[model samples]
Target: MTGAEAEGVRLQKVLANAGVASRRVSEQLIVEGRVRVNGVVVTELGSRIDPENDLVDVDGTAVQLDQSKRYVMLNKPTGVVSSMKDDRGRPDLRRFTKDWDERLYNVGRLDAETSGLLVLTNDGGLAHVLAHPSFGVTKVYIAKVEGAVTPQTVQRLLRGVDLDDGSIAADKARLLSTSAEGGGSLIELTLHAGRNRIVRRMMAAVGHPVVELVRRQFGPLHLGTLPAGRARELTKVERGALLTLARQAAGDDTVVRDGGEDPHTDQEI
Candidate 1:
């Protein structure tokens, strides 16, 4: 085999590529002495091993890097927590995809009271990029407020809201035409920040408490025609589009090596 293909790779990256868990979890495994390199217990997080030359084991089983990447989009239904599991016995995101044995984690979070698009994947780099606020991925939400949104309220949201953490603002927002009618107004809001319940709290701070909220879009990814409680693997074009948008947000000039855009691109707006 070529030297490039036989070169040594890092332990944490191997675990990440194996789809066993995230890089964070792999590091934890190293710290907990659950990982071994060549039969020697390895607790060092920085340890490296050659995929073909080294015998790296986690819990006594060998792990090999997964060349095939998987990306899934779930229309997260309300009441499911954004976790693989919970000790409090509360509902978790795992209930939605019980058929898969491959380890996958949520790309970002949606509160128990909120619902809509959620990304699941084993790609650590992609997950980190999407979750990082510095990437400025615009998350679009349709918020149902207790009363009609006034111009003043819109101004407050656009300018910024003072939360306990500090000032927060949306990238953009405007009233939307929805079937809910006059009881409550539907406002579309965009934010790059992923603070805890940020969208709900921001509107609440302006005296326009949200009655219901649905995340309609995340960057170039959208809920589209996917019905609630259903999910599908992301198409190659969709995945590339999301990566391009995220890279652009991070000030990177990532030109598409290949593939076209998704037909559902406009759904994010």
Candidate 2:
């Protein structure tokens, strides 16, 4: 055995530790040519690698190997800024992250008035791809708007509308329901738009200004009934899905011009 292989971790053990499966199952997967390291297929059970430095994947999905890297899902509440600290004394995210020892930051912003899911993590590479508009990662949001949202409004959102910045469109948009007394409507939108206050702008263009907005999903991750202002560590399956999304995004060449690519900064509605 080479000195480096002896010093490194076994492939199956690495996969097992990464939560892919049991050691035996991981070995079987390797033998079946379902594992890869640095883009090269590996079927050798005895192969070892530096988990900290080498990238690994099983069946085209990425595996999180670094134990120190943390992925957190937070249900951000309205009236709190998407930052860890607020210079103007406004409420920030410090309270939610106080229990964590690691320095975590939001992967993308949700406006102070907009509440819902925000991915908090120390993994900058994954955050970069997730937050970048060019990756075309879809986000789901439910918005309460001022007027009655009709099928025409949904069609407008799907067909695209011109804004001050440029033209924009939602991958999917529908009127979920309407409030009988308040003359407000709930609309759900699936989009990859990252422009500042994009949802508000789009609704306003359709004559239904948004009154409240809550993002419910980001890529493969969902808010899933988590109460506002709470945070939790991601499950193994969630981590696998998230890492897989980021991996797929990294190789995409689609051009998306929406702004706010920096995950550390808050910029969307």
Candidate 3:
């Protein structure tokens, strides 16, 4: 292995993970040579230090890394904005998470018209890795459309459609159980893309605009039987599963089977 590849963590990354400051702020400290490792000045951005063994001090104070990483899952109900703060003072996801002692932000967003499993975390790198399209985290949703479904429509959706924003397609699509009571069909769709209102727009393009939408799953995490407007912390196993999935999706070969599958491939809701 290359010497650089075998080196310890970057000072900026460790500081950012420590929540001492943003990665950019840590980089500035390095550039200004305000950061030291074991009583020695290290100004290079690529400078590495082991958080456990190295005594790193920033601005004369020892930097303490954060020990616990917060992970939360919420069954977000409709009419709540997914943002951390809303200028309009409208109902938002904060209503459910305000009780938490830790500061948390939405891992991914669901619009006001949509609802269901939303993950919230303080780990910015984990959030970015999971939510970014390159990771291919499949999101599953159950949607109520305005009309009846046809086989041809399903084929077209799977093949993809040209939306105003860009051409998009579902990774998987299937009508779960049809319902005649609501005069609309309850269809399940799974897609890897997170475009604004992509599910609704995809259905609209196929002549069946969405009437209601709810995200049922994100990665291996499910909304499950959780009621709307409630939020809870993810268990240790779930958190580990997420980290494993992220590594697997990123092409990390160190991941084991661990008795569960990665949610990179979108499944029918």
Candidate whose lDDT is highest: 2
Residues 141-162, candidate 1, lDDT per residue (tens digit)?
9988877777778888999999
lDDT of 3: 0.74
Cα RMSD (angstroms) for every candidate in the order listed: 13.8, 4.1, 12.4
| Best model per TM-score | 2
Instruction: State every prediction's TM-score relative to the real structure.
Output: 0.67, 0.90, 0.69
| Residue pairs of candidate 1 with colliding backbone atoms | none
Each candidate's clash count? 0, 0, 0
RMSD (Cα, Å) of candidate 1?
A: 13.8
Model 3 agreement with the true structure over 191-243: per-residue lDDT tens digits: 88867778888898998888889999999899889999899988645665676
* Sort order, TM-score high to low: 2, 3, 1
| Deviation from native of the Cα of residue 176 in model 1, angstroms | 1.7
TM-score of model number 3: 0.69
What would the per-residue lDDT of candidate 2 be over residues 124-232, giving only the tens digit for each residue? 7778778878878889999989967778879989999899999999999978998767789999999886889999999999888988899999999999989998999
